[model samples]
Target: MLKPEIKVLDVQGQYRIHTEFYRSDTAENTIILVNGSMATTASFAQTVKNLHPHLNVVLYDQPYAGKSKPHNQHQKMLTKELEAQMLLELIEHFSANYLMSFSWGGTAALTALACTPRRIEKAVISSFSPLINGPMRDYLERGRRCLADCNRTQVGNLVNDTLGKHLPSLFKRFNFKHVSSLAEHEYAQMHFHIEQVLTCDQPCLLDTASGIEIPVLFINGAWDEYTSASDAQHFVQSIENSQFVRLENTGHFLDMEHKSASHISKAAMLGFLQPAHAEHLAASR
Candidate 1:
Protein backbone atom coordinates (compact mmCIF):
# COMPACT_ATOMS: atom_id res chain seq x y z
CA MET A 1 0.00 0.00 0.00
CA LEU A 2 1.14 3.56 -0.65
CA LYS A 3 2.41 5.29 2.46
CA PRO A 4 0.14 8.24 2.97
CA GLU A 5 0.45 10.69 5.85
CA ILE A 6 -1.83 13.67 6.18
CA LYS A 7 0.03 16.99 6.12
CA VAL A 8 -1.13 20.54 6.71
CA LEU A 9 0.32 23.74 5.21
CA ASP A 10 -0.30 27.29 6.40
CA VAL A 11 -0.81 29.83 3.60
CA GLN A 12 -2.27 33.31 3.23
CA GLY A 13 -4.88 34.52 5.78
CA GLN A 14 -3.88 31.65 8.05
CA TYR A 15 -5.73 29.31 5.75
CA ARG A 16 -4.74 25.69 5.99
CA ILE A 17 -4.06 23.45 3.02
CA HIS A 18 -3.99 19.70 3.59
CA THR A 19 -2.56 16.81 1.51
CA GLU A 20 -1.28 13.25 1.64
CA PHE A 21 2.49 13.02 1.81
CA TYR A 22 4.27 9.92 0.49
CA ARG A 23 7.38 10.45 2.56
CA SER A 24 10.97 9.30 1.84
CA ASP A 25 13.80 11.02 3.73
CA THR A 26 16.61 8.79 2.42
CA ALA A 27 16.08 10.12 -1.08
CA GLU A 28 18.22 12.40 -3.21
CA ASN A 29 15.83 14.00 -5.74
CA THR A 30 12.47 14.85 -4.14
CA ILE A 31 9.38 14.67 -6.41
CA ILE A 32 6.21 16.69 -5.96
CA LEU A 33 3.13 15.31 -7.72
CA VAL A 34 0.48 17.71 -9.00
CA ASN A 35 -2.88 16.50 -10.20
CA GLY A 36 -4.90 17.72 -13.14
CA SER A 37 -8.05 19.73 -12.56
CA MET A 38 -11.08 17.85 -11.17
CA ALA A 39 -8.65 15.34 -9.62
CA THR A 40 -6.58 14.96 -6.47
CA THR A 41 -3.13 13.64 -5.63
CA ALA A 42 -4.77 10.34 -4.68
CA SER A 43 -4.54 9.58 -8.38
CA PHE A 44 -0.77 9.05 -8.01
CA ALA A 45 -1.00 6.67 -5.06
CA GLN A 46 -0.23 3.56 -7.09
CA THR A 47 2.54 5.17 -9.14
CA VAL A 48 4.85 6.64 -6.48
CA LYS A 49 4.44 3.86 -3.93
CA ASN A 50 6.78 1.46 -5.72
CA LEU A 51 9.36 4.08 -6.68
CA HIS A 52 13.04 3.76 -5.78
CA PRO A 53 13.30 3.83 -1.98
CA HIS A 54 16.10 6.36 -2.42
CA LEU A 55 13.89 9.06 -3.99
CA ASN A 56 11.57 11.22 -1.91
CA VAL A 57 7.96 11.55 -3.13
CA VAL A 58 5.15 13.91 -2.20
CA LEU A 59 1.63 14.17 -3.54
CA TYR A 60 -0.30 17.27 -2.57
CA ASP A 61 -3.80 18.44 -3.44
CA GLN A 62 -4.04 21.82 -5.11
CA PRO A 63 -5.79 24.68 -3.29
CA TYR A 64 -9.25 23.69 -4.47
CA ALA A 65 -8.92 19.92 -4.47
CA GLY A 66 -8.95 17.34 -1.68
CA LYS A 67 -8.34 18.84 1.76
CA SER A 68 -6.54 21.94 0.50
CA LYS A 69 -8.35 25.19 1.31
CA PRO A 70 -9.87 27.02 -1.63
CA HIS A 71 -8.57 30.51 -2.24
CA ASN A 72 -10.54 33.39 -0.78
CA GLN A 73 -13.58 34.47 -2.78
CA HIS A 74 -12.23 38.02 -3.01
CA GLN A 75 -8.66 36.88 -3.74
CA LYS A 76 -9.00 34.56 -6.71
CA MET A 77 -6.80 32.57 -9.14
CA LEU A 78 -7.73 34.04 -12.49
CA THR A 79 -4.28 35.19 -13.60
CA LYS A 80 -0.98 33.34 -13.97
CA GLU A 81 0.37 35.38 -11.05
CA LEU A 82 -2.07 33.81 -8.58
CA GLU A 83 -1.36 30.34 -9.92
CA ALA A 84 2.39 30.98 -9.64
CA GLN A 85 1.92 32.20 -6.09
CA MET A 86 0.12 29.01 -5.12
CA LEU A 87 2.93 26.99 -6.69
CA LEU A 88 5.48 28.93 -4.67
CA GLU A 89 3.42 28.31 -1.53
CA LEU A 90 3.41 24.56 -2.07
CA ILE A 91 7.12 24.39 -2.96
CA GLU A 92 8.11 26.52 0.05
CA HIS A 93 5.77 24.60 2.32
CA PHE A 94 7.31 21.28 1.31
CA SER A 95 10.72 22.46 0.10
CA ALA A 96 10.21 20.13 -2.86
CA ASN A 97 12.60 20.33 -5.83
CA TYR A 98 11.08 18.17 -8.55
CA LEU A 99 7.61 17.97 -10.11
CA MET A 100 5.53 15.22 -11.73
CA SER A 101 2.58 16.93 -13.36
CA PHE A 102 -0.40 15.64 -15.35
CA SER A 103 -2.51 16.91 -18.29
CA TRP A 104 -3.66 20.54 -18.12
CA GLY A 105 -1.56 20.62 -14.97
CA GLY A 106 1.45 20.58 -17.31
CA THR A 107 0.51 24.09 -18.32
CA ALA A 108 -0.26 25.34 -14.82
CA ALA A 109 2.74 23.60 -13.32
CA LEU A 110 4.98 25.09 -16.01
CA THR A 111 3.51 28.48 -15.30
CA ALA A 112 4.32 28.10 -11.64
CA LEU A 113 7.88 26.93 -12.20
CA ALA A 114 8.70 29.51 -14.87
CA CYS A 115 7.38 32.25 -12.61
CA THR A 116 9.63 31.12 -9.78
CA PRO A 117 12.71 29.35 -11.14
CA ARG A 118 14.24 29.16 -7.69
CA ARG A 119 11.52 26.77 -6.53
CA ILE A 120 11.80 23.65 -8.71
CA GLU A 121 14.81 21.45 -9.52
CA LYS A 122 13.30 19.57 -12.48
CA ALA A 123 9.90 18.47 -13.84
CA VAL A 124 8.16 15.57 -15.58
CA ILE A 125 4.86 15.84 -17.43
CA SER A 126 2.53 12.85 -17.93
CA SER A 127 -0.09 13.15 -20.67
CA PHE A 128 0.75 16.81 -20.67
CA SER A 129 0.76 19.68 -23.17
CA PRO A 130 2.23 23.09 -22.55
CA LEU A 131 -0.13 24.54 -25.16
CA ILE A 132 -3.85 23.88 -25.61
CA ASN A 133 -4.91 23.79 -29.27
CA GLY A 134 -7.30 21.03 -30.34
CA PRO A 135 -10.30 19.08 -29.00
CA MET A 136 -9.33 19.64 -25.37
CA ARG A 137 -9.24 23.30 -26.29
CA ASP A 138 -12.76 23.06 -27.65
CA TYR A 139 -14.00 21.01 -24.70
CA LEU A 140 -12.61 23.52 -22.25
CA GLU A 141 -14.29 26.33 -24.15
CA ARG A 142 -17.61 24.51 -23.93
CA GLY A 143 -17.05 23.94 -20.22
CA ARG A 144 -16.31 27.61 -19.60
CA ARG A 145 -19.44 28.52 -21.54
CA CYS A 146 -21.41 26.24 -19.23
CA LEU A 147 -19.81 27.81 -16.14
CA ALA A 148 -20.57 31.34 -17.32
CA ASP A 149 -24.18 30.27 -17.81
CA CYS A 150 -24.26 28.84 -14.24
CA ASN A 151 -25.12 25.40 -15.52
CA ARG A 152 -24.01 23.33 -12.56
CA THR A 153 -26.07 20.35 -13.62
CA GLN A 154 -24.54 20.64 -17.07
CA VAL A 155 -21.13 20.81 -15.46
CA GLY A 156 -21.80 17.72 -13.35
CA ASN A 157 -23.27 15.93 -16.32
CA LEU A 158 -20.30 16.80 -18.55
CA VAL A 159 -17.79 15.30 -16.12
CA ASN A 160 -19.84 12.14 -15.87
CA ASP A 161 -20.27 12.06 -19.62
CA THR A 162 -16.54 12.42 -20.33
CA LEU A 163 -15.67 9.68 -17.88
CA GLY A 164 -18.31 7.37 -19.28
CA LYS A 165 -17.44 8.06 -22.88
CA HIS A 166 -13.66 8.03 -22.78
CA LEU A 167 -12.80 6.19 -19.58
CA PRO A 168 -15.61 3.98 -18.35
CA SER A 169 -13.22 1.46 -16.85
CA LEU A 170 -11.22 4.19 -15.17
CA PHE A 171 -14.35 5.64 -13.58
CA LYS A 172 -14.94 2.29 -11.91
CA ARG A 173 -11.33 2.15 -10.70
CA PHE A 174 -11.74 5.20 -8.44
CA ASN A 175 -13.89 4.28 -5.46
CA PHE A 176 -13.81 7.85 -4.26
CA LYS A 177 -15.13 7.81 -0.74
CA HIS A 178 -15.07 11.60 -0.46
CA VAL A 179 -15.30 12.65 -4.13
CA SER A 180 -18.48 10.62 -4.41
CA SER A 181 -19.77 12.39 -1.31
CA LEU A 182 -19.14 15.90 -2.66
CA ALA A 183 -21.94 18.47 -2.45
CA GLU A 184 -22.95 21.53 -4.53
CA HIS A 185 -19.87 23.68 -3.92
CA GLU A 186 -17.68 20.80 -4.96
CA TYR A 187 -19.60 20.45 -8.19
CA ALA A 188 -19.61 24.19 -8.80
CA GLN A 189 -15.89 24.35 -8.17
CA MET A 190 -15.38 21.78 -10.87
CA HIS A 191 -17.18 24.03 -13.35
CA PHE A 192 -15.25 27.09 -12.23
CA HIS A 193 -12.00 25.18 -12.49
CA ILE A 194 -12.69 24.16 -16.06
CA GLU A 195 -13.35 27.76 -16.90
CA GLN A 196 -10.16 28.83 -15.15
CA VAL A 197 -8.13 26.28 -17.08
CA LEU A 198 -9.49 27.37 -20.45
CA THR A 199 -8.78 31.02 -19.72
CA CYS A 200 -5.55 31.17 -17.72
CA ASP A 201 -2.68 33.15 -19.31
CA GLN A 202 -0.08 30.58 -20.34
CA PRO A 203 1.68 31.77 -23.50
CA CYS A 204 4.21 33.73 -21.52
CA LEU A 205 5.17 30.64 -19.64
CA LEU A 206 5.36 28.59 -22.84
CA ASP A 207 7.66 31.19 -24.34
CA THR A 208 9.80 31.19 -21.22
CA ALA A 209 9.91 27.40 -21.25
CA SER A 210 12.35 27.52 -24.18
CA GLY A 211 14.90 29.02 -21.81
CA ILE A 212 14.45 26.59 -18.91
CA GLU A 213 17.67 24.56 -18.83
CA ILE A 214 16.29 21.98 -16.39
CA PRO A 215 15.86 18.32 -17.25
CA VAL A 216 12.20 18.29 -18.28
CA LEU A 217 10.60 14.95 -19.08
CA PHE A 218 7.44 14.64 -21.18
CA ILE A 219 5.52 11.37 -20.82
CA ASN A 220 2.64 10.76 -23.18
CA GLY A 221 0.16 7.95 -23.67
CA ALA A 222 0.49 6.35 -27.11
CA TRP A 223 -3.26 6.48 -27.63
CA ASP A 224 -4.01 9.72 -25.86
CA GLU A 225 -6.94 11.63 -27.31
CA TYR A 226 -5.65 14.91 -25.93
CA THR A 227 -1.98 14.88 -26.89
CA SER A 228 -0.08 12.60 -29.24
CA ALA A 229 3.57 11.66 -29.82
CA SER A 230 3.99 14.61 -32.14
CA ASP A 231 3.05 16.94 -29.34
CA ALA A 232 5.72 15.38 -27.19
CA GLN A 233 8.25 15.61 -29.99
CA HIS A 234 7.39 19.24 -30.62
CA PHE A 235 7.61 20.01 -26.92
CA VAL A 236 11.01 18.38 -26.58
CA GLN A 237 12.28 20.01 -29.74
CA SER A 238 11.13 23.40 -28.47
CA ILE A 239 12.29 23.14 -24.88
CA GLU A 240 15.96 22.85 -23.97
CA ASN A 241 17.15 19.48 -22.59
CA SER A 242 13.66 17.93 -22.61
CA GLN A 243 13.03 14.20 -23.06
CA PHE A 244 9.87 12.45 -24.28
CA VAL A 245 8.54 8.95 -23.63
CA ARG A 246 5.56 7.38 -25.36
CA LEU A 247 3.73 4.77 -23.29
CA GLU A 248 1.89 2.02 -25.15
CA ASN A 249 -1.91 1.54 -25.45
CA THR A 250 -2.83 4.37 -23.08
CA GLY A 251 -4.96 7.47 -23.45
CA HIS A 252 -5.25 10.98 -22.06
CA PHE A 253 -4.91 9.65 -18.53
CA LEU A 254 -1.36 8.38 -18.03
CA ASP A 255 -0.72 8.25 -14.29
CA MET A 256 -4.03 6.46 -13.93
CA GLU A 257 -4.22 3.76 -16.60
CA HIS A 258 -0.79 3.58 -18.22
CA LYS A 259 1.62 0.89 -16.99
CA SER A 260 4.44 3.35 -17.62
CA ALA A 261 2.73 5.69 -15.17
CA SER A 262 2.53 2.99 -12.49
CA HIS A 263 5.11 2.11 -9.86
CA ILE A 264 6.95 0.09 -12.48
CA SER A 265 7.51 3.25 -14.48
CA LYS A 266 8.67 5.05 -11.40
CA ALA A 267 11.58 2.62 -11.36
CA ALA A 268 12.52 3.78 -14.84
CA MET A 269 12.51 7.36 -13.64
CA LEU A 270 14.65 6.37 -10.67
CA GLY A 271 17.24 4.94 -13.02
CA PHE A 272 17.15 8.00 -15.26
CA LEU A 273 17.54 10.38 -12.32
CA GLN A 274 20.60 8.53 -11.05
CA PRO A 275 24.14 9.67 -11.79
CA ALA A 276 26.21 8.61 -14.81
CA HIS A 277 27.19 5.31 -13.16
CA ALA A 278 23.61 4.06 -13.07
CA GLU A 279 23.08 5.29 -16.62
CA HIS A 280 26.02 3.09 -17.54
CA LEU A 281 24.39 0.15 -15.74
CA ALA A 282 21.14 0.70 -17.69
CA ALA A 283 23.07 0.92 -20.98
CA SER A 284 25.20 -2.17 -20.36
CA ARG A 285 22.12 -4.21 -19.54
Candidate 2:
Protein backbone atom coordinates (compact mmCIF):
# COMPACT_ATOMS: atom_id res chain seq x y z
CA MET A 1 0.00 0.00 0.00
CA LEU A 2 1.25 3.46 -0.90
CA LYS A 3 1.07 5.90 1.98
CA PRO A 4 -0.15 9.45 1.38
CA GLU A 5 1.81 12.59 2.05
CA ILE A 6 -0.40 14.76 4.21
CA LYS A 7 -0.46 18.55 4.10
CA VAL A 8 -2.66 21.54 4.88
CA LEU A 9 -3.19 24.08 2.11
CA ASP A 10 -4.20 27.70 2.61
CA VAL A 11 -6.98 28.54 0.19
CA GLN A 12 -6.41 32.20 -0.68
CA GLY A 13 -6.27 32.96 3.07
CA GLN A 14 -9.97 32.25 3.41
CA TYR A 15 -9.71 28.59 4.53
CA ARG A 16 -7.24 25.85 5.35
CA ILE A 17 -7.86 22.52 3.63
CA HIS A 18 -6.36 19.26 4.85
CA THR A 19 -5.21 17.13 1.93
CA GLU A 20 -3.63 13.71 1.31
CA PHE A 21 -1.58 13.13 -1.81
CA TYR A 22 -0.64 9.66 -3.04
CA ARG A 23 1.92 10.27 -5.75
CA SER A 24 2.35 7.44 -8.24
CA ASP A 25 5.90 7.09 -9.56
CA THR A 26 4.89 5.63 -12.91
CA ALA A 27 1.57 7.29 -13.66
CA GLU A 28 1.40 10.46 -15.71
CA ASN A 29 -2.01 11.58 -14.48
CA THR A 30 -3.17 12.95 -11.13
CA ILE A 31 -6.78 12.97 -10.05
CA ILE A 32 -8.50 14.73 -7.18
CA LEU A 33 -11.13 12.70 -5.33
CA VAL A 34 -13.64 15.10 -3.82
CA ASN A 35 -15.73 14.01 -0.86
CA GLY A 36 -19.47 14.37 -0.54
CA SER A 37 -21.27 16.23 2.25
CA MET A 38 -20.50 14.87 5.75
CA ALA A 39 -17.59 12.87 4.28
CA THR A 40 -13.95 13.38 5.12
CA THR A 41 -10.69 12.42 3.46
CA ALA A 42 -10.96 9.07 5.22
CA SER A 43 -14.08 8.30 3.22
CA PHE A 44 -11.91 7.79 0.14
CA ALA A 45 -9.22 5.68 1.74
CA GLN A 46 -10.20 2.59 -0.17
CA THR A 47 -10.53 4.54 -3.37
CA VAL A 48 -7.06 5.97 -2.95
CA LYS A 49 -5.70 2.48 -2.42
CA ASN A 50 -7.42 1.37 -5.59
CA LEU A 51 -6.16 4.26 -7.74
CA HIS A 52 -2.72 5.19 -6.37
CA PRO A 53 -0.93 2.33 -8.16
CA HIS A 54 -2.37 3.50 -11.49
CA LEU A 55 -2.74 7.26 -10.98
CA ASN A 56 -1.68 9.90 -8.52
CA VAL A 57 -4.60 10.53 -6.17
CA VAL A 58 -5.46 13.54 -4.02
CA LEU A 59 -8.04 13.62 -1.25
CA TYR A 60 -9.14 16.45 1.01
CA ASP A 61 -11.42 17.29 3.86
CA GLN A 62 -13.75 20.08 2.82
CA PRO A 63 -14.51 22.96 5.19
CA TYR A 64 -16.20 21.91 8.43
CA ALA A 65 -15.39 18.26 7.85
CA GLY A 66 -12.56 16.19 9.34
CA LYS A 67 -9.43 18.26 10.00
CA SER A 68 -10.46 21.11 7.68
CA LYS A 69 -12.23 23.45 10.04
CA PRO A 70 -13.82 26.71 8.98
CA HIS A 71 -11.51 29.70 9.19
CA ASN A 72 -14.29 31.62 10.81
CA GLN A 73 -15.82 29.19 13.24
CA HIS A 74 -18.80 31.49 13.66
CA GLN A 75 -19.53 31.15 9.94
CA LYS A 76 -19.68 27.39 9.64
CA MET A 77 -21.95 27.32 6.64
CA LEU A 78 -20.37 26.52 3.20
CA THR A 79 -21.57 27.72 -0.17
CA LYS A 80 -21.06 26.10 -3.57
CA GLU A 81 -19.14 29.12 -4.86
CA LEU A 82 -16.72 28.97 -1.97
CA GLU A 83 -16.26 25.24 -2.44
CA ALA A 84 -15.59 25.78 -6.16
CA GLN A 85 -12.86 28.27 -5.35
CA MET A 86 -11.20 25.79 -3.05
CA LEU A 87 -11.21 23.13 -5.78
CA LEU A 88 -9.73 25.60 -8.26
CA GLU A 89 -6.92 26.34 -5.85
CA LEU A 90 -6.22 22.64 -5.46
CA ILE A 91 -6.18 22.13 -9.21
CA GLU A 92 -3.64 24.91 -9.64
CA HIS A 93 -1.46 23.61 -6.82
CA PHE A 94 -1.43 19.99 -8.00
CA SER A 95 -1.64 20.44 -11.78
CA ALA A 96 -4.36 17.83 -11.68
CA ASN A 97 -5.37 16.11 -14.94
CA TYR A 98 -8.57 14.46 -13.80
CA LEU A 99 -11.30 14.75 -11.16
CA MET A 100 -13.55 12.22 -9.43
CA SER A 101 -16.21 13.48 -7.06
CA PHE A 102 -19.12 12.04 -5.14
CA SER A 103 -22.55 13.40 -4.28
CA TRP A 104 -22.47 17.05 -3.14
CA GLY A 105 -18.79 17.26 -4.02
CA GLY A 106 -19.93 16.95 -7.65
CA THR A 107 -21.58 20.33 -7.24
CA ALA A 108 -18.26 22.01 -6.51
CA ALA A 109 -16.51 19.95 -9.19
CA LEU A 110 -19.08 20.97 -11.82
CA THR A 111 -18.94 24.59 -10.71
CA ALA A 112 -15.15 24.58 -11.01
CA LEU A 113 -15.32 22.82 -14.38
CA ALA A 114 -17.70 25.46 -15.68
CA CYS A 115 -15.32 28.20 -14.58
CA THR A 116 -12.20 26.56 -16.03
CA PRO A 117 -12.75 23.53 -18.22
CA ARG A 118 -9.31 23.72 -19.80
CA ARG A 119 -7.54 23.01 -16.52
CA ILE A 120 -8.99 19.49 -16.16
CA GLU A 121 -8.78 16.86 -18.92
CA LYS A 122 -11.71 14.71 -17.82
CA ALA A 123 -13.95 14.07 -14.83
CA VAL A 124 -15.90 11.27 -13.15
CA ILE A 125 -18.79 12.44 -10.99
CA SER A 126 -20.87 9.94 -9.02
CA SER A 127 -24.26 10.22 -7.36
CA PHE A 128 -24.97 13.87 -8.07
CA SER A 129 -27.69 15.94 -9.72
CA PRO A 130 -28.38 19.64 -9.97
CA LEU A 131 -32.03 19.06 -9.21
CA ILE A 132 -32.87 17.92 -5.68
CA ASN A 133 -35.58 15.30 -5.48
CA GLY A 134 -38.45 15.49 -2.98
CA PRO A 135 -37.28 12.50 -0.95
CA MET A 136 -33.72 13.84 -0.76
CA ARG A 137 -34.96 17.25 0.28
CA ASP A 138 -37.01 15.71 3.09
CA TYR A 139 -34.01 13.66 4.22
CA LEU A 140 -31.78 16.71 4.40
CA GLU A 141 -34.53 18.66 6.12
CA ARG A 142 -34.93 15.95 8.73
CA GLY A 143 -31.19 15.87 9.41
CA ARG A 144 -31.08 19.67 9.59
CA ARG A 145 -33.91 19.71 12.08
CA CYS A 146 -32.23 17.05 14.14
CA LEU A 147 -29.02 19.04 14.24
CA ALA A 148 -30.93 22.22 15.04
CA ASP A 149 -32.35 20.42 18.04
CA CYS A 150 -28.88 19.07 18.99
CA ASN A 151 -30.18 15.52 18.83
CA ARG A 152 -27.05 13.64 17.83
CA THR A 153 -28.51 10.22 18.48
CA GLN A 154 -31.50 10.88 16.27
CA VAL A 155 -29.20 12.31 13.65
CA GLY A 156 -27.28 9.04 13.70
CA ASN A 157 -30.55 7.19 13.42
CA LEU A 158 -31.52 9.29 10.44
CA VAL A 159 -28.36 8.31 8.59
CA ASN A 160 -28.76 4.66 9.52
CA ASP A 161 -32.37 4.78 8.47
CA THR A 162 -31.51 6.06 5.05
CA LEU A 163 -28.06 5.22 3.67
CA GLY A 164 -27.08 2.78 6.34
CA LYS A 165 -30.05 0.52 5.70
CA HIS A 166 -28.61 -0.34 2.32
CA LEU A 167 -25.38 -1.68 3.76
CA PRO A 168 -24.75 -5.33 4.65
CA SER A 169 -25.90 -6.42 8.11
CA LEU A 170 -22.53 -6.22 9.82
CA PHE A 171 -21.60 -3.04 8.03
CA LYS A 172 -24.96 -1.54 8.94
CA ARG A 173 -24.25 -1.99 12.63
CA PHE A 174 -20.79 -0.54 12.21
CA ASN A 175 -22.14 2.45 10.31
CA PHE A 176 -24.68 3.20 13.03
CA LYS A 177 -22.06 2.96 15.75
CA HIS A 178 -19.61 5.14 13.88
CA VAL A 179 -22.17 7.83 13.19
CA SER A 180 -23.42 7.73 16.77
CA SER A 181 -19.93 8.28 18.06
CA LEU A 182 -19.16 11.44 16.10
CA ALA A 183 -18.17 14.49 18.18
CA GLU A 184 -20.51 17.42 18.74
CA HIS A 185 -18.60 19.71 16.41
CA GLU A 186 -18.85 17.05 13.71
CA TYR A 187 -22.61 17.09 14.10
CA ALA A 188 -22.64 20.87 13.74
CA GLN A 189 -20.52 20.62 10.61
CA MET A 190 -22.89 18.03 9.17
CA HIS A 191 -25.81 20.34 9.95
CA PHE A 192 -24.20 23.20 8.08
CA HIS A 193 -23.46 20.92 5.11
CA ILE A 194 -27.07 19.77 4.98
CA GLU A 195 -28.16 23.39 5.12
CA GLN A 196 -25.90 24.24 2.20
CA VAL A 197 -27.47 21.51 0.07
CA LEU A 198 -31.03 22.45 1.04
CA THR A 199 -30.46 26.12 0.20
CA CYS A 200 -28.28 25.76 -2.94
CA ASP A 201 -29.45 27.42 -6.17
CA GLN A 202 -30.22 24.53 -8.50
CA PRO A 203 -31.11 26.49 -11.63
CA CYS A 204 -27.96 28.52 -11.37
CA LEU A 205 -25.91 25.33 -10.96
CA LEU A 206 -27.72 23.76 -13.90
CA ASP A 207 -26.80 26.78 -15.99
CA THR A 208 -23.19 26.47 -14.85
CA ALA A 209 -23.11 22.76 -15.75
CA SER A 210 -24.27 23.41 -19.31
CA GLY A 211 -21.03 25.22 -20.09
CA ILE A 212 -18.71 22.34 -19.20
CA GLU A 213 -17.02 20.91 -22.33
CA ILE A 214 -14.67 18.34 -20.83
CA PRO A 215 -15.41 14.64 -21.29
CA VAL A 216 -17.22 13.39 -18.20
CA LEU A 217 -18.48 10.07 -16.86
CA PHE A 218 -21.49 10.58 -14.59
CA ILE A 219 -22.36 7.57 -12.42
CA ASN A 220 -25.45 7.07 -10.33
CA GLY A 221 -27.20 4.19 -8.58
CA ALA A 222 -30.46 2.92 -9.97
CA TRP A 223 -31.70 2.47 -6.40
CA ASP A 224 -30.50 5.82 -5.09
CA GLU A 225 -33.45 7.90 -4.01
CA TYR A 226 -31.38 10.89 -3.01
CA THR A 227 -30.10 11.23 -6.57
CA SER A 228 -32.31 9.32 -8.93
CA ALA A 229 -31.04 7.84 -12.20
CA SER A 230 -33.45 9.92 -14.28
CA ASP A 231 -32.33 13.13 -12.63
CA ALA A 232 -28.69 12.17 -13.11
CA GLN A 233 -29.33 11.49 -16.80
CA HIS A 234 -30.98 14.88 -17.16
CA PHE A 235 -27.98 16.57 -15.59
CA VAL A 236 -25.60 14.63 -17.87
CA GLN A 237 -27.49 15.79 -20.95
CA SER A 238 -26.32 19.34 -20.34
CA ILE A 239 -22.65 18.39 -20.58
CA GLU A 240 -21.71 18.03 -24.27
CA ASN A 241 -19.18 15.19 -23.83
CA SER A 242 -20.55 13.07 -21.05
CA GLN A 243 -21.76 9.49 -20.47
CA PHE A 244 -24.03 8.21 -17.74
CA VAL A 245 -23.81 4.80 -15.99
CA ARG A 246 -26.38 3.49 -13.56
CA LEU A 247 -25.29 0.79 -11.11
CA GLU A 248 -28.06 -1.62 -10.31
CA ASN A 249 -28.98 -2.27 -6.63
CA THR A 250 -26.75 0.56 -5.46
CA GLY A 251 -27.75 3.58 -3.42
CA HIS A 252 -26.38 7.01 -2.54
CA PHE A 253 -23.19 5.57 -1.00
CA LEU A 254 -21.59 3.77 -3.91
CA ASP A 255 -18.32 2.96 -2.21
CA MET A 256 -20.04 1.64 0.85
CA GLU A 257 -22.74 -0.35 -0.93
CA HIS A 258 -23.04 -4.13 -0.88
CA LYS A 259 -20.20 -6.15 -2.43
CA SER A 260 -21.56 -6.66 -5.94
CA ALA A 261 -22.80 -3.12 -6.37
CA SER A 262 -19.67 -1.61 -4.86
CA HIS A 263 -17.43 -3.76 -7.04
CA ILE A 264 -19.27 -2.68 -10.20
CA SER A 265 -19.13 1.00 -9.28
CA LYS A 266 -15.42 0.84 -8.50
CA ALA A 267 -14.68 -1.05 -11.71
CA ALA A 268 -16.58 1.49 -13.75
CA MET A 269 -14.69 4.39 -12.18
CA LEU A 270 -11.30 2.74 -12.57
CA GLY A 271 -12.00 1.74 -16.15
CA PHE A 272 -13.06 5.24 -17.19
CA LEU A 273 -10.06 6.83 -15.50
CA GLN A 274 -7.49 4.57 -17.16
CA PRO A 275 -4.85 6.56 -19.01
CA ALA A 276 -5.56 4.91 -22.37
CA HIS A 277 -9.26 5.67 -22.17
CA ALA A 278 -8.56 9.23 -21.02
CA GLU A 279 -6.14 9.77 -23.89
CA HIS A 280 -8.62 8.42 -26.40
CA LEU A 281 -11.36 10.68 -25.04
CA ALA A 282 -9.02 13.67 -25.09
CA ALA A 283 -8.04 12.96 -28.69
CA SER A 284 -11.68 12.66 -29.74
CA ARG A 285 -12.31 16.04 -28.14
Q: Which predicted model would earn the best lDDT?
A: 2
Candidate RMSDs in order: 4.0, 4.0
**Which residues of candidate 1, in runs, are more than 4 Å off?**
69-80, 145-170, 173-193, 196-205, 258-264, 275-285
- Clashes by residue pair, model 2: none
- Predicted candidate 1 versus true structure: per-residue lDDT over 27-134, tens digit per residue: 666677777666776666666665535556777665656667453232334344555566667777777888777766776677666665675777877777656658
lDDT by residue for model 2 (1-285), tens: 667898888885767888889988888889998887767787776677667667889898875767776533536556677888889999989989899998878888998898864569889999887777898888888988887777867877888788556767766676667667766676776777677667777776678788788889989888788887788877655788888888998888776776687667767876787857545544776
User: What would the TM-score be for candidate 1 when compared with the true structure?
Assistant: 0.78
List the candidate 2 regions with Cα displacement exceeding 4 Å.
70-76, 181-189, 200-202, 275-285
* Candidate 2 Cα lDDT to native: 0.79
Q: Count the backbone clashes (under 3 Å) in each candidate.
A: 0, 0
